[model samples]
Target: MDTMKRLGGDAFAPQTTYLNSASTGLIPAAGVAAMHEGVQATAAGRPLDHFRDVEAARAAFARLAGVPARQVATGASVAVYAGLIAASLPDGAEVLLSEDDFSSLVNPFHSRPGLKVRTVALEDLADSVRPGTDLVAFSQVQSADGRIAAVDAVREAARAHGARTLVDASQSAGWLPLPQADFLVAVGFKWLMGPRGITYLVVPEDLGGLTPLLAGWVAGEQPWDSCYGPVAELAHSARRFDISPSLYSYAGAVAGFELLDHLGIAAVRAHDAALADRFRAGLAELGHTPVHAPGSAIVSVPGLGARQPQLSAAGIEVSDRAGNLRASFHLYNSSDDVDRLLHSLT
Candidate 1:
């Protein structure tokens, strides 16, 4: 499949190879069209319904997560859910997580007063938790090194230990089936191929009416009522967690979801796995060891800080983290991109 041309010609600039999907995905043409339609409608004083767009985005996100629509909520970012979850916990609560995970999931709790945040190796996530651990928070795929998380094992351990599980699926959801958790969040900008400023949160119905850390009118039963009188009741569904989303972002996210649905996620994952294997093999041939375990889509070549600039000069867009040259494979990447990267490295 010539995904580069099909997904969007505008998304893929000429002579540029984008291998940094882990950072920000190439926004699809569908997303761009959706955003434009929304902007134009509003400018014309005939605004498209914001509620309808957000609900569509939420449903699309739920489909990707393999969860029910009621289980999904739209938020500003993963930090919104992370902070709400953190604030829901009492001060001095013990949270078990990886030091390598993204800061959005960790820093919220760390910045809070009296919380004891304990760092564990990503490989030892399940083993690190024991009884009395209040929460287990981490990413399904580490953003730094792009290691696939053994989250099923962690979930099992968290269940046994009575610890609430929080998964940040920012790097994994569009690439793999999500692991069940008490709370799961994914940004639309990354693998979802949507605009930034949109995030989806999965909150199971069993969690019940959570007190919104940041309350708003939308979360209430009657947002349209001008009484300003009764609190009434918050939504029983994940709608309670929604503070609302950027209208344009929501529109783009809705379109992105539909595009992925048409492409089929299973095929997307297989393509990524193959690309990863090819890139790893190529990197090895270049005498550069891959930083992640076998078959990871995020390939890191450490201590090649200068090599990244040369690749950039050659029109390859990748990332450098902690002195490691990080190249992430997505559905858009082709074998040609891998060949280009490997040839540049040599």
Candidate 2:
């Protein structure tokens, strides 16, 4: 099967090969068209009619994330972090997290008074859980080193310690399997091939003891009621975190989700894993060491002193993040791109 045709024409243009899907995916033409249509719909003064597509986007996101539509909210990953942290913790409660966790997930708890924050190294995760830890927050895949944590083990540990689990799937979603957790947050931009400003917060249906700190108009049960009235009951799922809707982002997400559905996530995952393996093999032949061996779709090859510019001059578009030459592969990337990158490195 030709993967290039599956990625659409926009992804095939020979200007610059995008091996940075871990950073920000290249928006396909279908996504662009969806965004344009969303704008046009709003400009026509029929915003009410746009709700269908908005709901469809929500449902598509939920389906892709393997959760119910109500359990999926659309927002930035930071917003999801804020909502999840606020809804899952109480005053004076401590939330245990890794020292290398994303700053967005840590900042909210750090800003609150009486909220204790503990940071542990990933190597000490099995022994890190304590009795007083209210929530254990970590990422399924570490963005920096591409190290995949044993999420099931962490979840079980957290459960044994009477703590909830919050997972950051920003670097893992759409490319890896959804690990079991109490709550999971994923951004659409990175691996989902969607536009930015959209993310999903998955909350289990049976767990509901905390209240959201930043509830807004769309969060209440009767969101259309008078602005000055009593706060209605919050929704049972992640929609309680929806402060407001971004119709344009929703449309773009719908297109992205459709593309993924067409290609089939299982196939995409297999193709990406193969590509990462190929890239890693090539990088090894060139005497470069990979950060964590290609675990997911992301492969990080550490370059020797100041070799990035030379590699770029040879027509490889790689990112230098934290002193590592990160070469990310997606379904759109072919074996030829890997060969070209290897040729450049040598």
For each of the candidates, the C-alpha root-mean-square deviation to the true structure, in angstroms, is 2.4, 2.8
State residue 191's C-alpha deviation in candidate 2, in Å: 1.0
Colliding residue pairs in candidate 2 = none
lDDT of each: 0.80, 0.72
Using lDDT as the measure, the top candidate is: 1
**Which candidate should be chosen as best, given TM-score against the real structure?**
1
Task: Kindly list the per-residue Cα lDDT of model 2 for residues 1-346, writing each as its tens digit.
Answer: 7642234435435457667777887676777887887677678975545456667877886776677787776666665555556556678787888776677776777776778888888767757888987887888887765778778888888889998888888887777877877877788887777888777777777534546665676777666762555557776666677757666777676667777778777778777777788888877777777877446777776654256677666666777776777777776688777777777777
Per-residue lDDT of 121 in model 2: 84
Model 2 segments more than 4 A misplaced: 2-14, 44-48, 83-88, 226-230, 303-315
Give a tens-digit lDDT track for model 1, residues 1-346.
6442223324444358889988998777677787898899999999988788888888888887778998887888888789888888877789998976798899898888888889988888899998779899999888878888888999999889888889999988777777888889989898888889988889867753356766566666566651366547776677777775688987777766776787787777778878888888887777888786665778777888557788888799999887888888887788888888888888
Q: Report the number of clashing residue pairs per model.
A: 0, 0
**After superposition on all CA atoms, how large is the RMSD of candidate 2?**
2.8
Q: Score candidate 1 by lDDT.
A: 0.80
Off by over 4 Å in 1: 1-15, 226-231
